[model samples]
Target: MEKTDNIQKKIIEDVIYNAEKILEAFNNELDGVLDYSVKSLEVIDDDLLSQFHENLHDVDETMKENAIIQFGSYIFEVARRNYGGKYYWYEQLDQPILVTGQPDFEISILAFEKVKQRIENGYEDNIPFFFKGYVQKLATAKKGDKELIC
Candidate 1:
């Protein structure tokens, strides 16, 4: 009985330790992603969007298609970097961070803009709710860590 109990306790402790490490890594990754997104937004000049559209209009048919493909690829890279990529290490943690984005550049931009416009039009309530859920999960995981320590 004593040996069984000891083994169980050890297993629980190991799980807790692993969970803590995963959570820390997740938080660090999220911070980095958020910073990158902010920087990307900052670098977008006022006329860049218009310029992109204008260039698309002026290019030959083949070049236009190529430009569209390249632009889509670029958007995917940015989205992947900013919104969690192929390996979601964070998902291994107690509270996983769910990343949401479209792979299609046209749809991605349209959706992003729609969301932005909605928020600007006073639909900001959902944003807080969404973040609250994420924050609560993190807090819960932190509490779990403390419980494990005790």
Candidate 2:
């Protein structure tokens, strides 16, 4: 993925690299257990959600913080591979967001926040359900339904 926009590019390079590393680690550690399919949100669940939640109190601050990026990076990769999403730095929020633009509409995902939410609230923040809903909405969206970027 070449740099597209100046704003998004600023962080996208690091994000892309981190995302790739996360995927590679998964392939090795899980022995290719987690497939980067449409329902690949579990990649995040497997990578850090399980750890962070299981050892919430025992974990160090650095691991806790890094887990967000590590898990979120995997989420971005899965979304990119499965949903045709791309990373763009959102200047206002100052973070890279995954944007999957369809002919009818766009599916923008705050992948890190999704990870953070899952780490904090567990299943109530349902990353799988979120992607499932987005897939459903994308399927139902018509060309003339209006172009929404969010």
C-alpha RMSD by candidate, in order? 16.8, 3.5
Each prediction's number of clashing residue pairs? 0, 1
Quote the positional error of residue 61 for candidate 1 in Å.
1.7
Model 1 lDDT per residue over 4-25, tens place: 5675455334433443442344
Output the number of the lDDT-best candidate. 2
Which pairs of residues have clashing backbones in candidate 1?
Answer: none
Output the TM-score of candidate 1: 0.29
Against the true structure, what is each candidate's TM-score?
Answer: 0.29, 0.76
- Highest TM-score, which number? 2
CA lDDT, every model vs. true structure: 0.32, 0.67
- The lDDT, on a scale of 0 to 1, for candidate 2 is 0.67
- Deviating ranges (above 4 Å) for candidate 2: 1-12, 144-150
